[model samples]
Target chain A: MNDDVTIATAQQLIEFLGTFAFAISGIRHAAAKHFDWFGGYVCGIAVAIGGGTIRDVMLGATPFWMTNPIYIICTALALCMVILCSKRMERLQNAWFVFDTLGLALFTIAGIQKSLDYGQPFWVAIIMGCITGSAGGVIRDILLNNEPVILRKEIYAMASVAGGFVYWGLSELDVAIQLTALLSFVITCAIRFLAVRYHVSLPQLKTDDEINRVDNG
Target chain B: MNDDVTIATAQQLIEFLGTFAFAISGIRHAAAKHFDWFGGYVCGIAVAIGGGTIRDVMLGATPFWMTNPIYIICTALALCMVILCSKRMERLQNAWFVFDTLGLALFTIAGIQKSLDYGQPFWVAIIMGCITGSAGGVIRDILLNNEPVILRKEIYAMASVAGGFVYWGLSELDVAIQLTALLSFVITCAIRFLAVRYHVSLPQLKTDDEINRVDNG
Candidate 1:
């Protein structure tokens, strides 16, 4: 009589999968920065939950991770995986990047869905999607003492933006929820992968000279 | 009998004052980084609200700035102040530094007060105090592409922690709320000023060698 149990378990599994991938990406960066074990685990958890936390705060909802222990467990597992495979992971340069991109795609879709469920407008949903996909890395980069590459380098947030538009458009066309989510994820990953692979990037703003001149006046 | 109106206005004024100072500091740093007007304004808002946002999220409360428009107005006004006096502010270094220190002190007191209001423990209140004092600068530095100086420099967070302990201790002694807040402010600023005056600083972590050795083994 009820599919709720089955759907809830499936959702939990995907959330855990995404959290683990994000945590691995964070732990790798923390290791690169030579953070102690506890520090590394903290970074892992931060990267795993940062985006969703931001979204939840904006939506006036309790953070998703605080309601469940799965994210924390997944983060610990990710830390262990990284510690055990540090030497080998160092050789597999693309591994964390792939996982990071996949995590971004999944989180973006989930973020947009959550925002929609909150009855937020489409623009807010898109922005929330971008935040979901990219804010984890932004926070991680901050923790690692580096400027977030998203703000300057990668074609990152744009992919999430593009995916948000497609997901919304699909829904407007009466697409089913599962199919719409799948399409959005595929679009996000495809855009991200293609852009990174082809060296596509946004133009860097150059305002030094202009700002200087204005100030001098 | 509804002096709620008068007290609310006074609280709003102080909140705006602190927000303005924080946004000014953030705008100054963004200006040094040569960010465009829009970029600089974004950075300023981020720094102004970042600390309290983190505190509110952890407390499961709505972000303080979101419920009112005053904080946003304060940030915009701060941006305008920086723009109008970019050259003059550069000359009045001591003035801006004083404002920043005052901002830190006030935010620390306010943060601890908020946490206590939420019925959080003393330790959590103390940590939240440090975060409210320092996390804005951390976020600002990250956005500007640098390691947060608070992690290794001066007595920034320590001062907040000390103030938190003092405030909690005084409260335990049944000190009045107003007096406790004022004393905490003075203590935080005194520690920060004394430390800066004497060149006190925490040592940088150097764990790369140990971590590398462990990995090699």
Candidate 2:
């Protein structure tokens, strides 16, 4: 019982930190676009909870944010942080990267566990994990009117997928759930850090002319 | 019983036509981008069912398309139509406008009714109606890497909101459900048609410099 309580508390803490970090990321982007406070708050809330909301909706569960006001509060706090510390925040790119990766790792694990609890198969759970980690950023980019970075560059979602596979493999080998989550988080963060450090990215899709020719042929 | 059967048939037919029109719109846009056929199909499917899927997910219901493969089949048929009649389809702009308006109207009504059936308040239902009518296009634009036209150019979603209010008022006056739906649909389409014909639109958001000043102050 004590161990269960500890694990649950740890999970909750991770979720809270993840929410704050995601919100900060969104607000910082909105600041770059010079969106008004309301717009920034909307973006912050979206990037903080959008993925988990999508995951819950797809899994036929009530959206996690709708049930708790904390996420909104967290976003508001993030917006304030951006407004008050704009210069300092700009100088803290490394810290921002760490927080974003942390958020990504936690969200992916949370998604996988939720899917399993809902009786989804491993494949679906893995997809959900990637969605949870990445869809929020996609939504943020959409709102900011940018081509989604996930589709155009980076190995971000791939890292989430990798963590999901780690979770699946470890579970199959009868690992404890808490240990599995910890390892998955570590693996996800490690992959993202390494990929960014090495400037690794997926190949771009075929050019328009090439795609058109193929289609015509 | 006969009337009920007829209403059900009409609804289903509207859904089918709406799906087809929306998918065509998406695929045509994708083709312009010179996306591969598979990419076109993905875009088609996203615009065809994306709104309803969002509504269902928010309402904590299973996404409508998962249970019905007909929507996918409809999108496929739409892609084939686009491939075969590409030039003719471009010239049929008036016909496309009609079908798209019909879709917007029907989808708004359907969204309002579904939300009400799920025991949501009239206000929430109205918002859902607008979302259902307009969000698919937003998603399509995002995927195509354009700024959302709805946000920058048109009075599309507002028409849906207006229809939702009409539905609420007529229903409160004890109008029959079928008549309420029909009137709501007509109102939405009329507003949309008149707005486009008259070049009506909402103003753009504040400029970046203005927004930044507001934030700083």
Candidate 3:
């Protein structure tokens, strides 16, 4: 019983960290866009909970943030951090990137586990994982009026997808849940780190003219 | 019972027309952006169902489109119409505008009613109504890499909110549901029409610099 309680506490801690990291990323972007404080706070909350909300809605479950006020508090704290140390935070770009990657990894695993618990098929769970890991940034970009970087050239969603596949494989091989989650998280972070370091990106989709030319030919 | 069936049928018809119009708007925007056929279809689906999906999730209900394939078929038909008659459809811009306005009116009423049915307060319902009427367009703009026009200069969402107020007032006075819906729809459409005709718009939100100056002073 104590072991279960400890595990649950650890999971909650990871969730809080991930939410804070995502919220900070959103507030920084909002600051860059010259949004007011309220706008910054809204963007921060959206980024921190956006992915989980989408995942939960798709899985027909209550959104995790709605059940607890902790996520909101985390976002508020993130906003305060950004407001108080904007210059210092900007200088800690590398630190933020690491935190963001960690958040992505943790959210992906949580999304997969939740979907599976809700009896979704593995494929659907995998998609949910990717959505949980990446959709928040998409929402933030949309709000900031920027094209979603993940939809364009980032290796972001792909890394989440890869991590999901790894999770599925490990679960199939009867791996312990904690070990599987840890391995999946590490793999997701590794892929994101390597992709960014190596400047790897997916090919862009074909434009209308290209599709039309092919059709005519 | 016969009258009730007729009313239900009429409501379903309005929903189909709204879905079709919203899908067409999204597809046309995608085409203008040079997105390929698949991209256009995705945008169409997103715009057609996005708002309702958000509303349903917030209200803790299953998304409406999940239970009915008709919305998908409507979007498909819309895509076909766009593909076959792009030039002719452009010539019918005024007709499309009318259809789009009609859609906005219908969706706002529907959203308000759904929220009320789910036991939400009047204010929450009004917000849901505005979201239903305007959010799909915002999603489409984001997908097309444009700033959401509704956020910039359109009096679109305000019209929906106004209609929701009318609905709430009439409902509180014990008006028939059908009459309430009709009045709300008409009010929404009229506001949209008059606003567009007279160039009405809400003021833009204050930027970071403006807020900072105010704080300092």
Clashes of 2: 0
Give the better candidate number (1 or 3) by DockQ: 1
Candidate 1 local distance difference test against the native: 0.80
**Interface RMSD measured for model 1:** 4.8
TM-score of chain A of each: 0.87, 0.92, 0.91
lDDT per residue (tens digit) for residues B18-55 in model 1: 67878988777776666555456657877888898899
As a whole number from 0 to 100, the lDDT of residue B185 in candidate 3 is 93
**What C-alpha lDDT, on a 0 to 100 scale, does residue B130 get in candidate 2?**
80
Residues B115-145 of candidate 2 have per-residue lDDT tens digits of 8899887877886788788889878988888
lDDT score, candidate 2: 0.86
TM-score ranking of the models = 2, 1, 3
Instruction: Quote model 3's TM-score for chain B.
Output: 0.91
> Can you give the lDDT of residue A117 in candidate 1?
91
Worst 10 residues of 3 chain B by lDDT: B202-211
lDDT, candidate 2, A25-46, per-residue tens: 8776766665556456656877
| Tens-place lDDT digits, model 1, residues A2-91 | 566876686566666678878988888898889988888988888899989888888887889899888898899889988887788777
Q: TM-score for the first chain of model 1?
A: 0.87
Those runs of model 1 whose alpha carbons end farther than 4 Å from true positions after fitting are: A1-50, A53-113, A119-127, A139-146, A153-217, B1-8, B31-46, B65-85, B143-145, B193-217
lDDT of 3: 0.85
After superposing candidate 2 on the true structure, give the runs of residues whose Cα lies further than 4 Å from its correct spot.
Answer: A1-45, A58-60, A65-138, A145-217, B1-6, B210-217
